[model samples]
Target: MGYGITLQVSGDYALFTRPEMKGERVSYDVMTPSAARGILEAILWKPAIKWIVDRITVLNRIDFESIRRNEVGSKIPPRNVTAAMGGAHVDLHQYPSEDRQQRASLVLRNVAYLIDAHFEMNPSKVGETDTPEKFYNMFLRRARQGQCFHNPYLGCREFAARFQLIDHTEQRLASHYADIEEMDLGWMLWDIEYGEERGKGKTMYSFQPKFYRTMMRNGVIEVSREVGL
Candidate 1:
């Protein structure tokens, strides 16, 4: 375990698209662990350190709303992009007009969550000067000053999130459904696990998503980092 921190995130809308659902987007009942990790990385991230979500606390009532959104159906191929970068003549652009489609999505509305997470140092990537405290302080400073590499979003880029670092020494806010004894949330996305290097320099890896059974007790979901298929 490394240094840990808590973040209070809120947004008007969030769309954590389910992996099984295609064409139409349907969000999960609550924020996903992967999304929470993304939010933390948006604030401060380094190759030497990796973020981990311990748990998440629902601060608002779970609610959903339906909306149709315009999205591009096709993306430029990676080969085309690489060829263009190498000065080869290649079509490396997406024609939104040709691929635009409106898809119905069920998304969360007026969402708020408290993310409890920590980061662990990657030995191979860590530098001589890199220390756990250094990264921890860096995250704290960036978070306190409202600085991020990019705008931290809830589940999607459009749904920008507002974040506040919960100073561990200060009083914490209460969960909205604290009165409830328990609630079953079923399976939820944890994060992605990448396979070992497929080539020299370890430049390429395979992507695989992991999910875990989740149960929310008193609006708080305790995540077991151990997740699998």
Candidate 2:
């Protein structure tokens, strides 16, 4: 058996950057499954369980807004930190004045979504006393109280999201696109998978991003469980 939750998430701005648009940040037409899972983890995350987003309901009409800002182009290299950790003095400071670049972003505005998701316990990680009901109750209590490990963001950290846990029996409000039929969303990022057998006794440091072609049916998107590239 699986325990699921329905949460209402809203934000003033969101930037779910498209992978193809390297120069400028361009958002997808709707929220992606991975982003929905991130919001759930922000509320309550446990290594013993994995969250699966089942569906996403777009509550408000999709709106796009463009903006430009000064941003850092790159981050400090990890090798520099490694050298500093070994007692060698290294310059690890980032100079915003030097790295700052003007960037444009196409973002979503006044976005709201209802995310329905469930969690599955990992047999290898779950303790003997850990039960589905235990975790379900924990999330239920914390979410209802508006408690989260960190403030959930829409996509970028700058745009914070506000959430409310809806009772399972409560009537869900109709979506803004309820009257509309299906709309193709093209290929969207599903999630990233990390695990590759390198050589003997070597750590898996590489990852692969997965994607899928999907559509929104009357403002709702059903997340697929099938695994593929």
Candidate 3:
């Protein structure tokens, strides 16, 4: 059996950008499995351990709000930066006034979730000193002490998230959707399967996006290896 931990995360605003909407930003009804894993990794992560999200519990009612914000239209080309670093003159600076564009976003407000997750030893990264129990204890210590490599955010970096450990023996806090029996979330982005590089020092890597049909029953989304996109 794998060791697991429960983290209670809450944020003021969240934008889980929907892939279909290219122009404007739209958020999913709930947190995706990948986002849950990200939060756990932020709290405590090591190359030897890979986080697996077991389930997510929605603790707040889904509320959406729209707002307009200025964003950059495009990013600076990497080639231009590389050339400039090599003493080749290239215009790499992008003035916000010229690139700024206003866009509306439909985002979730006052969101909270309880993420249940576990860690598995990465076969390639594991060493003689690495053990599941050792990493598990380290995660617990860091989480309880409010320590992290970086502050975890809710979908977007601008929206900060706060997290705490949940005790299993204690009664779980009630969810706003407790009265609702169930709901279908349609097809949602599951996670990106990153293609591994075969040779050393090779810059060949592929990112394949995956999706899954999500159904929430009594405010919980269960994730298992058997459930595939």
Candidate 4:
């Protein structure tokens, strides 16, 4: 799964506009120490800016079964499917774990779907031939740069309080973070309540890449990167 960030700037911030997001506020979620340094330099950002994540949106939820089904009777040869399972079993742990590149390729194809869902890009262009490819490529390039947004809001699920118009389907995002310190580069942290008797522990953190792998395994996100990994 993927998440998005929106910032409500105070004194000074990495104030910029995402062209793709239609002039919405852009706050880069620094994934690495180097990228963090870059942001510090680019915006002359200081720790004193009262910098806090404004909001985060988990972008995609991939699953394995959906992917398997899409390939049921496709005309093209399945690039990664080694053995066809006839209503058998699907286990994601059986796949490679270390190479995020391979997993990224698979996850990015459906990124356009998430982008469309969140940004609401014109759907009329999906069949324009170059449109889908361009949309896919744009997100791929951004992720490769280790770029992401940090949301300071309570979490994706509770963020609707700030929205004037809310769509339940869009609320599919799992709230990952409760506060600002949980912010990390490209890593979206939110809160989740499991049972009526909420368990107690040092709150767990869920990584997006891993979530994406799960999604790929579950078939929520349809794109697959089987070759370059």
Candidate 5:
């Protein structure tokens, strides 16, 4: 069976349990669309169904610290690796062809800014009551205004610098890998359901590492630097 994975924004999330840092790393889910389309293709075998993504929901916008402490370990490599390669380690076990394709999926490599104006809740006046409906609405509003930029071959740090999103302090957020299972993003959910099919042939996919290579060159040279090699 042919396959493809896509990511979409889910909803707004509070970055931290504490008040001051609550809105820090706030971002979106970025997930795969519905299975209905894929299912239809499986049943009907239609070529036209190829390369279609269903939807993108905004799960939550969380704090940067949480992203670092939680996701960095597993999602990325150790500091030594980063220092040596200027990116995550490359696992040679992946499907070289698929790995190459993923490098071009802008959505996967791009850095997305949590558009605070659309997603962050307005501070309540002195003694106003808050409700779930109000909170959910806030997320929806932010989803409408959410924005992201894709750097097909660049790491998070370089991508952020190129786009002027943050100074060095926020630089780590680009490569920090955290445990996003609780967030219910496509990667986490699919891992639980399909047992991580992507990893079946390889220990890990190659997108992140390839992105690293692109970043190290200061955005000058890319994997596909040659005209059509």
Candidate 6:
């Protein structure tokens, strides 16, 4: 366990796209744990520390809205990009007029959540001067001052998120959906686990996406350590 903090995040629209729906975009009812960690990292992150989401509190009703967005059908191939970078005269540009396609998306609207999380020091990346307390205090200061390395978004870059540190002393009321005792969120995407191995004096990295059966009780989703993150 490390120092813990609460952050309140709100956005007009959010799209935590479900992998099952390949063609159309459909968002989850609440923010994903990985997304919450990304928001915290955006505010303040260092290689020595990694954010762990303990729980999330939904502060607003989940509502979905349908919209159509213009998107490109395909992306420039890596081979073409490499050739262009090497001055081999390859066209790596994607013109909207030729590749434009409108896709329907079911996204969440007027969303707000309280993220309860903490940072754990990575011993492999920590230095002699790097301390958990130092990074924790730095995170608090930066979050309170409204500073972030980049603009934080709610799942999608276009749906910008606004965040603020929650004051523990301030009395706050429960959300409208707080009365609901329990709700099953089905299998939800947890996070991608990166594994690195060294063989033949070379290092190889692999990414594996993980999913867990998620449930919310009294408006709070408690992430379990037993899941092996």
TM-score result, candidate 5: 0.17
Candidate 4 off by > 4 Å: 1-117, 125-127, 131-134, 146-229
Worst 10 residues of 6 by lDDT: 220-229
TM-score to native of every candidate shown: 0.93, 0.94, 0.91, 0.17, 0.17, 0.91
Highest TM-score: give the candidate number.
Answer: 2
Candidate 5: tens digits of C-alpha lDDT, residues 1-229: 2232222221121121211223233322232122212222222222222323322222223233223321221223354554656565555243444433211112222223211111122344312555334543433343234322222111122222111222223432321223232322211111112223354554442321111111112111111212211
Off by over 4 Å in 5: 1-130, 146-229
lDDT by residue (tens digit), candidate 1, 61-113 = 99999999999987788878878988999877688999999899999999999
For residues 148-191, what per-residue lDDT tens digits would candidate 4 score against the true structure? 34321111111111111222334543322322233223222121
Q: Model 3: per-residue lDDT, tens digit, 148-179?
A: 99999889888889999987886788777777
Extract clashing residue pairs from model 2. none
Q: Tell how far residue 106 is off in model 3, in angstroms.
A: 0.4
Runs in model 6 deviating more than 4 A are 80-91, 198-204
Each candidate's clash count: 0, 0, 0, 35, 29, 0
Q: Candidate 2: list runs displaced more than 4 Å.
A: 85-87, 196-201
Model 4 reaches what TM-score against the true structure?
Answer: 0.17
The residue pairs found clashing in candidate 3 are none
**Ten consecutive residues with minimal summed lDDT in candidate 3?**
220-229
Q: 119-153 in candidate 6: lDDT tens per residue?
A: 89999999999998899889889999999999999
Quote the positional error of residue 36 for candidate 6 in Å.
0.5
